[model samples]
Target chain A: MKLLELVALEKRYGERPVLRGVDLAVDEGERVVLVGPSGCGKTTLLRLVAGLDAPDGGEIRLAGEVVSRAGAVIVSPEARGIGMVFQDLALWPHMTARENVAFPLRARGVPRRERDRRVAELLELVGLPDAGDRRPAELSGGQRQRVALARALAAEPRLLLLDEPFTSLDPELADRLRGDLVALQERLGFTLLHVTHDREEARQLATRVVTLHRGHLGEEAR
Target chain B: MSRRLVLGSAVLLLAIAGGLPVVAMLAQAFFAGGRFDPAPLAGLLTDAGTWRLLGSSILLAAAVALAACAAGIPLGVLLARTDLPGRRLLAALFTVPLLLPPWVLAVAWAALAGREGLLAPVVGPGAALALDRFLYGPGGCVLVLGTAFLPVPLLLTMAALAEIDPRLEEAGRLHAGWGTVLVRISLPLALPGLLLAAVLVFLLALGEFTVPGFFRVDVFATRSLERFAAFYDVRGATAAALPLAAAALLVLPLESAFLGRRGAPLPGAGTRRRTVPLGRFRAPALAGVLFVAGVLVALPLSALAARAAAPGAFREALARAGDALPRTIAWSVTGASLLLLGGVLLGLVVGRRELPGWRAVDGLALFLFALPGAVTGIGLVALWNRPATAFLYGTPLVVLLGWFARYAALPLRVTTAHLRGIPPALEEAARLAGASWWLRTRRVTLPLLGRGLFLAWIVGYVFCARDTAIAMLVYPPGRDTLPVRIVTLMANGTPGMVAALCLLATGVVLLPVAVVLPVLAISGREDRR
Candidate 1:
């Protein structure tokens, strides 16, 4: 069975239609990159899959369970075992690096010792061993980016969603982070669905590239 | 007090003033001879007179809210979004009344409508009598209370309008006319705050004792006071207070949610870019703002000034109110100080913890704040009229305590707003750095919230200074706040002298607000730079 499935997904805000009848599917461990023009509903699709929003029509299924359908969520985001790094990173600015990483574990009710151990490992994995003590405001751009990735990976989610997180980074730093992300995916074996406006970055990181034009999805040669 | 003691005591004080009294009254309402019985409450509910009073009260509140929103929302939108001439000056003038006590405004309106009122000579005897009759009933109460409470929505709506990204309007502008864009885009975005303001106005109108009292309107507020002070019926008073409290609780969640979503009263992204051109509307719009100012500010003040100009009348009014003036000022200062101390103690934990249940604290404060002054007075008497608490009940301390309880929420919420704006990452970062909640709050949150706390303090001071309803209910026999004195002297006193006393009360209230305004302006400028 496919790890994720979207069938005839439709959404609108008031009278303005967005994501009209979009359908796609991804197998376990497949890295899918969605490239689209601004306002083409790529982020909306990602948000729906992560259970942040419900669609207006049609259904979304994960692991053969319908998690979302028109106008309601069958499964909540946390219960769906999915993680998302928002376009703005959504790092809890009140939290330090490690606490942001450790938050999912704490929410999952892991004990302090185990939570601390996992947080420390994630920080080292992201090459931010000492940056754990600093807030998102104090951290550099690349460090904050890594902290978001470390946080997404902390709870060992079966699927991870990234929303144009590295768009602000320099090309050199973006390339390095992309390679590191690919390696991390290889080692951990989690499904990745990434949204980007950059064609080169999509080509570099995606196993299957898809173009979203006016809300419809089409396969692109990879 | 230690931080724990301070916090505990502040919460305890909040409980005492906000909860304990209401509980005391409700306890009487729900039980008789120490056995559970809903008979007294049910009696009030079933009474035909009780239903009439409730109906009248609801009608008065609905009329006032509708009237206030009718004026306030449009004014807020025009002032905030349009390039109306003298917009900034008009905005500031409109805001001045929020600091002035409502009864002061009532006194002004009375002066403008009385037998010897501003319009009495101009309109003549028959017309004046007819006007005074309307002004003294539900109609007059609605006009006065609605105008008195106008600033609440005005400030809230302007703040809401300021938050909408200019780009949203710009996007709409491309495909549609400005009118279409405003209706479809800007108005919808500003609707939350406009509605929130209307909700507050409705609650304020319902709880309005002063305007209704001055006008001789027999609404639930007046009825509650009559039940407590006139008939000495504790169960009856509590029974009367029940529905108002229930009304507050009904809307508590929405109020909390709306307030929680916004920052302080003024959140400016930059004033210049948000304004739209008034074009042909400027001259007419300026007339509307001037009319509002005349009705809300100038008429009352000028009436007082004209009244004060009467030979020896001002001094006689002063003599009658004598110590009440000083007492009101002293109690106001002391009350604001107590509220500030308590607010900081309570708010520090609520703001720092960043718990979801913080909304509960906010809702409780607002609910207590929304309770009719008569009910609050009744609650105070029920709780503290005993021999053991007689010392407090005998002094002006009770009135001061009442003020502290009523207005502490204003400051506490302000402090919490400031604390919330301190990014959550700051707390998480501190947590990771091995700092406990206390340490992080002490070292980070408190320092960041200093300005907010100060602003809240100033607001508390002005509100305490101007309050009359609670003071009238809770003040000891010999003591009266300025508001109570001015109100008392209104009956059988010279219209001029009464206006003078009202003006005096207005001055005391505005003093702190005036001092803070320039400082706030300077701070805002400094921030922009």
Candidate 2:
């Protein structure tokens, strides 16, 4: 069964349309990657799915529930149980890596012991075992990405959204992170909707590669 | 809901509380003969005494700005680059004088040079008398205002300095010595911020009435007041204040240009990685800070407190202005809240929207902020003193209107600037985590806005608390604000009693700031930009 559906998704800024007539779907455990050039609204489409923003004229359904339309949220972002790793790695600078990872659990009112245990397990899984106390600023570029990944996975999200999450890292680090993320996704068996401009990353990580052009989702490449 | 709607609300709030009063004042001034004639306003404008008042105001503002820059620049550099002792504490202490009314400093200086003052015995009688004479004129206005305003430049320069890439300074250091590099590179880069701060000081000094009034120095603000409060010449008062408003109107654009949409961001949650050791200059910089604190912060406060320390002086002052004290406190809180409300709305507009219309709103807010307090006060009276609006005019509401009109820009600018730096993802992440809008605001938005909200309150409250020029005109009979009460009581009350009241007012303003600043600094997220 489809875990996510974008039905004729359209978005615009005034008269200029950014994402027009975009249709897409992903199965419950499919690892789908979206590839696009700059300013192709890849991020916008992801934002719409995550309920970060509302589309101008379309509907988004998550797990068979209408979530967002042109100007309304049928289900709020948080209530949708979505987890997103932001393009810039929007880890709260005020929080340590451990706290950043644990915040979603805390927000969900998880007990302190459970939150701490999960946070540590996720950190260790992401290869950031000893960097839990360090702020995002103190961590290296690759480490920050790992911490973000750990955070995205902390809620045990049914679907995970990644938006150019490895863009800022060096090529080697990006490749390594991409491989680890693919392996993790396979192991966890969660549906993945990731946006990236790198064809190699998509080829390596995705079971299906989709392209967006002029706000329209092109035919599936794989 | 819509950006336009939010901005429209802000503009409407400003129009009611601030813009209408000026409109009423202008109408009164221009149509004094009950026609469209500009004869009275024209005559007042071209008059020699009017020109003299304008000249003196310009002169005073220039002198104060110059003095403030002179004091603020080196201190700013010291705080920013050098490993100064207790820099945060010093920065907070620097704003101490500013939290009090300008006139109180004049009162403190008066007490300091009096025959029974602290300095009377140390300094010879002749010297003390000479000092007394000096403290009661334009020199005194510049001295007091310059000291109060020094932090304006210092804070701005520190923020600007932080924004400068330290590598540029280091690159310069490879070629030239630190002093040469500082004068050549760091100083040049920070000039715009320094000048912007100076312009603020200029506008502030130009708009001030209290210091000059206490010193018996005749500037435009004092002239405007005397015409309204003393001689009951509303038209003449309006005429006198028109030039001051014109000055504000002319300068507001420059302020916007210099400060940008964010109204000149200040140093916050700065890292100490870029600091330079002062070496031999350390002692002098520390000594300079000490001297500034002594002259600007410590000395005047000691004198004021000493004068008030006489038995029953403080109590008598409080008893005399009993209702006025609480009334001032209560109105100031209400006024600050109102100001913050308008400020948040306007700030969101200015910070978020890139449209030119928001700039117009910004210009209007800044113009009203810099418009002479007497002008704002008289404008409120003219606008509200009528049968239809008699309820507002007959109570403290008019005074609150004056407060929001003149000072709301402060919080708006501060909050907007802070909001600008906060990424949209910060809230989105929270929202996607299942936090409701209310929960997001309380946890995400409010935490980010932590100190900024409190700082806005302080800015709004300090201005409202010490305000006199506007309060003096708009305050209803049998009701008095603390600043107005203290100034008026100076005539009938003993010197010691007045001094105690000034000290008491300072304490009132400082307590909240003292408690709030450190807590926010420590607890608030390291902005780590």
- What is each predicted model's overall lDDT from 0 to 1? 0.78, 0.79
TM-scores, in order shown? Answer: 0.69, 0.67
What C-alpha RMSD does candidate 1 show over the true interface residues after superposing them?
Answer: 15.7
Q: Deviation in angstroms for A142 in model 2?
A: 28
Top model number, DockQ:
1
lDDT per residue, candidate 2, B1-529, as tens digits? Answer: 4446655777788889988888999999888557887776888877888888788789989999999989888788888777888897787778677778888888887778655678978998998877877887888888888988888888888876775554344323322345655775577667667767877788889988778877878877777777887888888888788877887766665565455422222221211134665877788879879987888878887888889998999789778778887788789889888888778768866776634588777878888887878889889877888899898899988888888889988998788767866887998899799887557656787678767888898789888998878888888988988888888888678888988888777766666677777776766656432
lDDT of 2 by residue, A52-87 (tens): 557888899988889998876577555677777877
Local accuracy of candidate 1 as per-residue lDDT tens digits, B9-72: 7777888877788888888789888999888788888899988988888888989989988988
Poorest stretch of ten by lDDT in candidate 1 chain B: B264-273
Question: Candidate 1 regions off by >4 Å?
Answer: A1-222, B1-6, B124-126, B163-174, B257-273, B354-356, B424-443
| Candidate 2 segments exceeding 4 Å error | A1-222, B1-7, B32-34, B165-177, B260-273, B354-356, B427-444, B525-529
Native-to-model Cα distance after best TM-score fit, residue B179 in candidate 2, in Å: 2.8
